[model samples]
Target: MSKISKLFKGVSGSSSSSKSKHRARGGPSPHEAIHKLRDTEDMLTKKQDYLEKRIEQEVAIAKKHGTRNKRAALQALKRKKRLEQQLTQIDGTLSTIEFQRESLENSHTNSEVVRNMGYASQAMKKVHESMDLNKIDDLMDDINEQKDVAREINDAISRPQGDDFDEDELLAELEELEQEQMDDSMKSMGGLPSVPSGRLPSASTSYRATTKRREDEDDMRMLASWAT
Candidate 1:
């Protein structure tokens, strides 16, 4: 028994020494630590590359433009995200319905959950309907209204009967009459006397010189008054 006990002690001592050695080695050298850091950096680099590729794909999917297209794309992405969120909510509600269906076969509490689930489902349907509805309906209505207004305007302008209204000939005659009227206006305006070729002094310089001259006169008058 004593021999066996000594053997066990020796074995434990050996095991302890081996563990200490392993621990010393496991505490990595500075060089190994730097290498491991580099490896981690390489992994990060690969991950960044993958992410950049995904971003490039997204950019490629969109057309390039300024604010107008960018805003439109943002709106489209927002709509898609909203739809996805609704779908996820619908899925959760469906899951709840299944759970309630299985467990509470005939309870009033389960009935409420069923109704809640149904409402969520109905809400999801409504969102889909909203998405499906014509976004440009108002614009189309406005355009049609404008077209009707234009037609009304055209109808309101009562030109003489077809025989008297030769559009091409009338346009030519109207242009000639306008030219003649413009020529007469020009001749009338030309009858006025031509402006004198001289330019008056600038207002600022004129006022300054006049003020200075008046100040000099006043000074001279004061000197004269003193002399007198």
Candidate 2:
């Protein structure tokens, strides 16, 4: 058929053969598969670049010899067309490789997710095996009972020891003692000797008494005059 068609078929056949080989060998790991795809894509990209450069060079040659040599220009144009076709095929192949790589990546991600989920389930089963709902409830009950016992013990220790004393009786006894102390203080104060006034000379006292009697007479006379 056409060169492009032939090239496409050849690429497809080679890819199929590689896949079959991998499968026969127990299949490549996801990483290996991705690496292979990347390598193939890189090769295709380089080929595409080379084809594009060749096509550009062919187009340039065709334009330069357009009028001077018509036959040479036509041949250059034909080669450019062929290179363009090959570039198109490479683009298609690169697209396929990219799709395959993405598919492998998705599959690898799914496999990891499933494996992690399985591990989680197993861990949960193991945890459940070590624990019982009944045992948990019993443990809680024991803790509450111990807390109650501790609180009661604390209350017992905090309580006042011996018989309870009457507050009013204690206050009354304290007041009685204070009163007796105050009475003893008063008796002691009463036993203290009184201070005496100074004694005057007998002659001076007689003279002072006479002068006081004369003043009292003068005051009596003044009072009689005021009454009249």
TM-score winner = 2
**What lDDT does candidate 2 reach at residue 42?**
85
lDDT of 2: 0.93
Residues 1-228 of candidate 1 have per-residue lDDT tens digits of: 699999999999997986797588885444444454455545555655554555554454444433558876675555545545655554565565455444544454566788999999999998887673476677788899999999988887865555667699999999999999987998888755677799978999999999999999999999999998
Per-prediction TM-score: 0.20, 0.55
Candidate 2 local lDDT, residue 39: 91
Model 1: clashing residue pairs? none
lDDT of 2 by residue, 78-152 (tens): 999889889988888888899889999999999999999999999999999999999999999999999999999
